[model samples]
Target: MSGSHVRLEPLTMDHAAGLLEAGADPGIWAWLSSRQPVELGEAEAIVKAALTDPDRRAWAQIDLASGRFAGTTSYYQIVAKHRILSIGHTWIGAGFQRTALNTEAKFLLLRNAFESWGAQRVAWETDARNLRSQRAIERLGALREGLLRAHRIRPDGTSRDTVLYSMTDAEWPGARARLLARLG
Candidate 1:
Protein backbone atom coordinates (compact mmCIF):
# COMPACT_ATOMS: atom_id res chain seq x y z
CA MET A 1 0.00 0.00 0.00
CA SER A 2 1.32 3.37 -1.01
CA GLY A 3 0.48 6.78 0.39
CA SER A 4 1.90 10.25 -0.04
CA HIS A 5 3.72 10.21 3.27
CA VAL A 6 4.36 6.50 3.62
CA ARG A 7 4.48 3.23 1.69
CA LEU A 8 3.69 -0.18 3.10
CA GLU A 9 5.87 -3.01 1.86
CA PRO A 10 6.06 -6.61 2.95
CA LEU A 11 8.63 -6.75 5.76
CA THR A 12 11.80 -8.76 5.22
CA MET A 13 15.13 -9.50 6.83
CA ASP A 14 16.67 -6.77 4.69
CA HIS A 15 14.78 -4.19 6.75
CA ALA A 16 16.37 -5.26 10.05
CA ALA A 17 19.10 -2.64 9.98
CA GLY A 18 16.70 0.15 9.19
CA LEU A 19 14.25 -1.08 11.77
CA LEU A 20 16.95 -1.12 14.40
CA GLU A 21 18.04 2.39 13.53
CA ALA A 22 14.53 3.81 13.42
CA GLY A 23 13.64 1.99 16.61
CA ALA A 24 16.62 3.42 18.46
CA ASP A 25 14.43 5.42 20.77
CA PRO A 26 13.53 3.36 23.82
CA GLY A 27 10.29 5.25 24.31
CA ILE A 28 8.79 3.72 21.18
CA TRP A 29 8.84 0.28 22.74
CA ALA A 30 7.18 1.22 26.00
CA TRP A 31 3.66 0.22 24.96
CA LEU A 32 4.72 -2.53 22.61
CA SER A 33 4.80 -6.24 23.41
CA SER A 34 8.43 -6.77 22.49
CA ARG A 35 11.48 -5.25 24.10
CA GLN A 36 13.52 -2.71 22.16
CA PRO A 37 15.89 -4.28 19.69
CA VAL A 38 19.42 -3.19 20.47
CA GLU A 39 21.21 -4.91 17.61
CA LEU A 40 20.82 -6.12 14.05
CA GLY A 41 20.34 -9.69 15.29
CA GLU A 42 17.48 -8.71 17.57
CA ALA A 43 15.82 -6.73 14.82
CA GLU A 44 16.23 -9.68 12.47
CA ALA A 45 14.58 -11.90 15.04
CA ILE A 46 11.67 -9.49 15.21
CA VAL A 47 11.35 -9.52 11.41
CA LYS A 48 11.56 -13.27 11.30
CA ALA A 49 8.80 -13.65 13.86
CA ALA A 50 6.51 -11.38 11.91
CA LEU A 51 7.17 -13.26 8.68
CA THR A 52 6.68 -16.62 10.31
CA ASP A 53 3.48 -15.83 12.14
CA PRO A 54 0.65 -17.86 10.62
CA ASP A 55 -2.10 -15.36 11.30
CA ARG A 56 -0.25 -12.15 10.51
CA ARG A 57 0.41 -10.08 7.40
CA ALA A 58 3.15 -7.67 8.38
CA TRP A 59 4.46 -4.62 6.57
CA ALA A 60 7.35 -2.25 6.85
CA GLN A 61 6.24 1.37 6.87
CA ILE A 62 8.64 3.29 4.65
CA ASP A 63 8.83 7.03 5.11
CA LEU A 64 8.49 8.56 1.64
CA ALA A 65 10.59 11.63 2.33
CA SER A 66 13.68 9.71 3.41
CA GLY A 67 12.78 6.38 1.74
CA ARG A 68 13.71 4.52 4.89
CA PHE A 69 11.85 1.99 7.02
CA ALA A 70 9.92 3.94 9.60
CA GLY A 71 8.30 1.10 11.52
CA THR A 72 6.05 -1.92 11.28
CA THR A 73 2.34 -2.73 11.43
CA SER A 74 0.26 -5.80 10.84
CA TYR A 75 -3.10 -7.37 10.16
CA TYR A 76 -3.52 -10.18 12.64
CA GLN A 77 -6.17 -12.41 14.21
CA ILE A 78 -7.74 -12.75 10.80
CA VAL A 79 -10.78 -14.92 10.37
CA ALA A 80 -11.49 -15.21 6.66
CA LYS A 81 -14.86 -16.92 6.83
CA HIS A 82 -16.10 -14.41 9.34
CA ARG A 83 -14.52 -11.54 7.43
CA ILE A 84 -13.05 -10.12 10.62
CA LEU A 85 -9.54 -8.95 11.43
CA SER A 86 -7.64 -6.81 13.89
CA ILE A 87 -4.97 -4.22 13.23
CA GLY A 88 -2.28 -3.81 15.84
CA HIS A 89 1.38 -4.51 16.46
CA THR A 90 2.11 -1.07 15.20
CA TRP A 91 4.99 1.16 16.27
CA ILE A 92 6.22 4.30 14.58
CA GLY A 93 9.65 5.72 15.12
CA ALA A 94 9.87 8.79 17.33
CA GLY A 95 10.53 10.98 14.30
CA PHE A 96 7.49 9.65 12.44
CA GLN A 97 5.11 9.95 15.35
CA ARG A 98 2.54 12.77 15.13
CA THR A 99 3.15 12.94 11.37
CA ALA A 100 1.01 12.03 8.38
CA LEU A 101 2.72 8.67 8.15
CA ASN A 102 0.46 6.88 10.66
CA THR A 103 -2.77 8.26 9.29
CA GLU A 104 -1.96 7.31 5.72
CA ALA A 105 -0.67 3.91 6.71
CA LYS A 106 -3.87 3.13 8.62
CA PHE A 107 -6.07 4.53 5.88
CA LEU A 108 -4.42 2.20 3.38
CA LEU A 109 -4.79 -0.80 5.64
CA LEU A 110 -8.42 -0.10 6.49
CA ARG A 111 -9.21 0.47 2.82
CA ASN A 112 -7.70 -2.86 1.88
CA ALA A 113 -9.53 -4.69 4.65
CA PHE A 114 -12.93 -3.24 3.99
CA GLU A 115 -12.87 -2.78 0.20
CA SER A 116 -10.56 -5.46 -1.08
CA TRP A 117 -11.05 -8.21 1.49
CA GLY A 118 -14.76 -7.54 1.95
CA ALA A 119 -14.31 -7.54 5.66
CA GLN A 120 -17.29 -7.13 7.94
CA ARG A 121 -15.32 -5.58 10.77
CA VAL A 122 -11.87 -4.31 11.66
CA ALA A 123 -10.84 -4.18 15.30
CA TRP A 124 -8.09 -2.60 17.38
CA GLU A 125 -6.86 -3.12 20.90
CA THR A 126 -4.39 -1.16 22.93
CA ASP A 127 -3.08 -1.06 26.45
CA ALA A 128 -5.63 0.77 28.53
CA ARG A 129 -2.93 2.94 30.01
CA ASN A 130 -1.78 4.19 26.64
CA LEU A 131 -3.84 7.32 26.26
CA ARG A 132 -1.99 8.44 23.17
CA SER A 133 -2.81 5.27 21.29
CA GLN A 134 -6.42 5.39 22.39
CA ARG A 135 -6.73 8.95 21.16
CA ALA A 136 -5.13 8.09 17.85
CA ILE A 137 -7.59 5.23 17.29
CA GLU A 138 -10.52 7.44 18.17
CA ARG A 139 -9.21 10.02 15.72
CA LEU A 140 -9.40 7.36 13.04
CA GLY A 141 -13.14 7.12 13.81
CA ALA A 142 -13.16 3.68 15.39
CA LEU A 143 -15.82 3.37 18.05
CA ARG A 144 -14.70 2.29 21.47
CA GLU A 145 -16.59 -0.91 22.19
CA GLY A 146 -15.52 -1.74 25.72
CA LEU A 147 -12.59 -2.65 27.88
CA LEU A 148 -11.16 -6.10 28.59
CA ARG A 149 -9.65 -6.35 31.99
CA ALA A 150 -6.57 -8.45 32.46
CA HIS A 151 -6.60 -9.28 28.81
CA ARG A 152 -2.94 -10.08 28.64
CA ILE A 153 0.31 -9.99 30.49
CA ARG A 154 2.69 -7.17 29.82
CA PRO A 155 6.40 -7.62 29.23
CA ASP A 156 6.94 -6.49 32.80
CA GLY A 157 4.82 -9.45 33.97
CA THR A 158 1.87 -7.39 35.06
CA SER A 159 -1.73 -7.92 34.01
CA ARG A 160 -2.75 -5.42 31.36
CA ASP A 161 -6.24 -4.20 30.68
CA THR A 162 -7.05 -3.64 27.02
CA VAL A 163 -9.18 -0.97 25.42
CA LEU A 164 -11.05 -2.26 22.42
CA TYR A 165 -12.29 -0.37 19.37
CA SER A 166 -13.93 -1.36 16.13
CA MET A 167 -15.19 -0.13 12.76
CA THR A 168 -17.74 -2.17 10.91
CA ASP A 169 -18.34 -2.20 7.18
CA ALA A 170 -21.35 -0.01 7.86
CA GLU A 171 -19.06 2.54 9.47
CA TRP A 172 -16.28 2.37 6.87
CA PRO A 173 -17.60 5.00 4.51
CA GLY A 174 -17.69 7.70 7.14
CA ALA A 175 -14.39 6.60 8.60
CA ARG A 176 -12.80 6.58 5.15
CA ALA A 177 -13.98 10.09 4.46
CA ARG A 178 -12.66 11.30 7.79
CA LEU A 179 -9.28 9.71 7.16
CA LEU A 180 -9.04 11.25 3.69
CA ALA A 181 -9.87 14.65 5.06
CA ARG A 182 -7.12 14.29 7.64
CA LEU A 183 -4.64 13.25 4.99
CA GLY A 184 -5.57 16.34 2.97
Candidate 2:
Protein backbone atom coordinates (compact mmCIF):
# COMPACT_ATOMS: atom_id res chain seq x y z
CA MET A 1 0.00 0.00 0.00
CA SER A 2 1.32 3.44 -0.89
CA GLY A 3 1.62 6.35 1.53
CA SER A 4 3.12 9.82 1.45
CA HIS A 5 6.43 8.74 2.91
CA VAL A 6 6.38 4.98 2.45
CA ARG A 7 4.80 2.16 0.53
CA LEU A 8 4.14 -1.25 1.99
CA GLU A 9 4.46 -4.07 -0.45
CA PRO A 10 3.77 -7.71 0.21
CA LEU A 11 6.78 -9.22 1.92
CA THR A 12 8.59 -11.51 -0.49
CA MET A 13 12.02 -12.94 -1.23
CA ASP A 14 12.69 -9.86 -3.30
CA HIS A 15 12.58 -7.84 -0.08
CA ALA A 16 15.01 -10.04 1.82
CA ALA A 17 18.10 -8.32 0.49
CA GLY A 18 16.69 -4.87 1.04
CA LEU A 19 15.68 -5.73 4.56
CA LEU A 20 19.09 -7.14 5.35
CA GLU A 21 20.76 -4.01 4.01
CA ALA A 22 18.38 -1.62 5.71
CA GLY A 23 18.50 -3.33 9.05
CA ALA A 24 22.25 -3.55 9.25
CA ASP A 25 22.31 -1.68 12.51
CA PRO A 26 22.98 -4.07 15.39
CA GLY A 27 20.77 -2.00 17.65
CA ILE A 28 17.68 -2.29 15.48
CA TRP A 29 16.79 -5.83 16.56
CA ALA A 30 17.22 -5.38 20.30
CA TRP A 31 13.57 -5.46 21.30
CA LEU A 32 12.09 -7.00 18.19
CA SER A 33 10.15 -10.27 18.35
CA SER A 34 12.99 -12.32 16.99
CA ARG A 35 16.68 -12.34 17.71
CA GLN A 36 18.97 -10.25 15.52
CA PRO A 37 20.08 -11.95 12.39
CA VAL A 38 23.87 -11.70 12.43
CA GLU A 39 24.22 -11.87 8.66
CA LEU A 40 22.36 -11.66 5.38
CA GLY A 41 21.63 -15.39 5.34
CA GLU A 42 20.03 -15.26 8.74
CA ALA A 43 18.02 -12.21 7.72
CA GLU A 44 16.81 -14.16 4.70
CA ALA A 45 15.76 -16.96 7.03
CA ILE A 46 13.68 -14.55 9.05
CA VAL A 47 11.98 -13.35 5.92
CA LYS A 48 11.37 -16.95 4.89
CA ALA A 49 9.77 -17.75 8.23
CA ALA A 50 7.48 -14.74 7.99
CA LEU A 51 6.54 -15.81 4.47
CA THR A 52 5.72 -19.29 5.71
CA ASP A 53 3.56 -18.28 8.61
CA PRO A 54 0.02 -19.42 7.86
CA ASP A 55 -1.74 -16.74 9.86
CA ARG A 56 0.38 -13.73 8.97
CA ARG A 57 0.04 -11.15 6.23
CA ALA A 58 3.44 -9.51 6.10
CA TRP A 59 4.60 -6.38 4.34
CA ALA A 60 7.87 -4.68 3.60
CA GLN A 61 7.98 -1.04 4.66
CA ILE A 62 9.60 1.07 1.96
CA ASP A 63 10.60 4.70 2.25
CA LEU A 64 9.09 6.54 -0.69
CA ALA A 65 11.40 9.50 -0.97
CA SER A 66 14.53 7.40 -1.29
CA GLY A 67 12.90 4.15 -2.34
CA ARG A 68 14.72 2.43 0.49
CA PHE A 69 13.51 -0.59 2.36
CA ALA A 70 12.62 0.66 5.84
CA GLY A 71 11.53 -2.48 7.67
CA THR A 72 8.79 -5.04 8.13
CA THR A 73 5.38 -5.17 9.75
CA SER A 74 2.55 -7.65 9.76
CA TYR A 75 -1.10 -8.23 10.38
CA TYR A 76 -1.09 -11.49 12.23
CA GLN A 77 -3.09 -13.57 14.68
CA ILE A 78 -5.97 -12.86 12.39
CA VAL A 79 -9.33 -14.24 13.42
CA ALA A 80 -11.48 -13.34 10.46
CA LYS A 81 -14.63 -14.74 12.00
CA HIS A 82 -14.06 -12.55 15.02
CA ARG A 83 -13.07 -9.61 12.86
CA ILE A 84 -9.96 -9.15 14.94
CA LEU A 85 -6.29 -8.95 14.08
CA SER A 86 -3.01 -7.53 15.36
CA ILE A 87 -0.49 -5.08 13.98
CA GLY A 88 2.88 -5.87 15.35
CA HIS A 89 6.26 -7.39 14.71
CA THR A 90 7.11 -4.00 13.30
CA TRP A 91 10.62 -2.60 13.04
CA ILE A 92 11.99 0.26 11.00
CA GLY A 93 15.60 0.82 10.14
CA ALA A 94 17.55 3.50 12.04
CA GLY A 95 17.35 6.03 9.23
CA PHE A 96 13.57 5.77 8.99
CA GLN A 97 12.76 6.02 12.67
CA ARG A 98 11.27 9.31 13.90
CA THR A 99 10.20 10.11 10.35
CA ALA A 100 6.66 10.34 9.02
CA LEU A 101 7.16 6.98 7.35
CA ASN A 102 5.98 5.04 10.42
CA THR A 103 2.95 7.24 11.04
CA GLU A 104 1.88 7.01 7.42
CA ALA A 105 2.54 3.30 7.27
CA LYS A 106 0.41 2.76 10.35
CA PHE A 107 -2.34 4.89 8.94
CA LEU A 108 -2.41 2.76 5.81
CA LEU A 109 -2.40 -0.46 7.80
CA LEU A 110 -5.12 0.61 10.20
CA ARG A 111 -7.21 1.96 7.38
CA ASN A 112 -6.97 -1.34 5.59
CA ALA A 113 -7.89 -3.25 8.72
CA PHE A 114 -10.82 -1.23 9.94
CA GLU A 115 -12.26 -0.01 6.68
CA SER A 116 -11.44 -2.59 4.06
CA TRP A 117 -11.55 -5.67 6.25
CA GLY A 118 -14.39 -4.52 8.51
CA ALA A 119 -12.38 -5.43 11.53
CA GLN A 120 -13.90 -4.80 14.92
CA ARG A 121 -10.57 -4.36 16.63
CA VAL A 122 -6.87 -4.08 15.91
CA ALA A 123 -4.55 -5.04 18.70
CA TRP A 124 -0.94 -4.08 19.34
CA GLU A 125 1.61 -5.26 21.85
CA THR A 126 5.19 -4.43 22.56
CA ASP A 127 7.81 -5.36 25.07
CA ALA A 128 7.09 -3.54 28.29
CA ARG A 129 10.57 -2.11 28.24
CA ASN A 130 10.01 -0.50 24.86
CA LEU A 131 8.97 3.02 25.73
CA ARG A 132 9.33 4.23 22.17
CA SER A 133 6.83 1.72 20.86
CA GLN A 134 4.39 2.43 23.68
CA ARG A 135 4.47 6.14 22.95
CA ALA A 136 4.03 5.56 19.23
CA ILE A 137 0.99 3.32 19.73
CA GLU A 138 -0.50 5.73 22.20
CA ARG A 139 -0.04 8.52 19.70
CA LEU A 140 -2.20 6.49 17.35
CA GLY A 141 -5.00 6.76 19.94
CA ALA A 142 -5.05 3.08 20.83
CA LEU A 143 -6.12 2.47 24.38
CA ARG A 144 -3.78 0.81 26.77
CA GLU A 145 -5.64 -2.21 28.00
CA GLY A 146 -3.19 -3.78 30.42
CA LEU A 147 0.07 -5.54 30.73
CA LEU A 148 0.50 -9.21 30.05
CA ARG A 149 3.15 -10.45 32.38
CA ALA A 150 5.39 -13.14 31.02
CA HIS A 151 3.45 -12.98 27.81
CA ARG A 152 6.00 -14.89 25.82
CA ILE A 153 9.54 -16.01 25.65
CA ARG A 154 11.89 -13.52 24.09
CA PRO A 155 14.50 -14.46 21.60
CA ASP A 156 17.06 -14.16 24.35
CA GLY A 157 15.22 -16.87 26.34
CA THR A 158 13.85 -14.50 28.94
CA SER A 159 10.13 -14.15 29.57
CA ARG A 160 8.85 -10.90 28.16
CA ASP A 161 6.29 -8.63 29.73
CA THR A 162 3.96 -7.26 27.09
CA VAL A 163 2.06 -4.01 27.10
CA LEU A 164 -1.24 -4.56 25.38
CA TYR A 165 -3.16 -1.94 23.45
CA SER A 166 -6.10 -1.90 21.09
CA MET A 167 -8.24 0.36 18.96
CA THR A 168 -11.76 -0.83 18.37
CA ASP A 169 -13.91 0.23 15.43
CA ALA A 170 -15.49 2.80 17.70
CA GLU A 171 -12.11 4.44 18.24
CA TRP A 172 -10.96 4.38 14.65
CA PRO A 173 -12.60 7.59 13.52
CA GLY A 174 -10.73 9.74 15.98
CA ALA A 175 -7.52 7.82 15.38
CA ARG A 176 -7.89 8.32 11.67
CA ALA A 177 -8.29 12.03 12.16
CA ARG A 178 -5.16 12.22 14.26
CA LEU A 179 -3.24 10.30 11.64
CA LEU A 180 -4.44 12.60 8.92
CA ALA A 181 -3.31 15.61 10.88
CA ARG A 182 0.10 14.03 11.32
CA LEU A 183 0.38 13.28 7.64
CA GLY A 184 -0.41 16.90 6.88
Query: Could you say which candidate leads in TM-score?
Result: 1
Task: Report the lDDT tens digits of candidate 2 across residue range 1-184.
Answer: 8977999999998888888888888788889877777678888899999999998999999999999899999999999999999999899999999999999999999999999999999999999999989999999999999999999888889999999999999999999998999899
Q: Please give the TM-score that candidate 1 achieves against the real structure.
A: 0.99
Per-residue lDDT of candidate 1, residues 1-184 (tens digit)? 8989999999989999999999999999999988999989999999999999999999999999999889999999999999999999999999999999999999999999999999999999999999999999999999999999999999989999999999999999999998999899
Model 2 pairs whose backbones collide: none
Highest lDDT, which number?
1
Which 10-residue window in model 2 sums to the lowest lDDT?
33-42
For candidate 1, what's the RMSD? 0.6
Clashes of each: 0, 0
RMSD of each: 0.6, 0.8
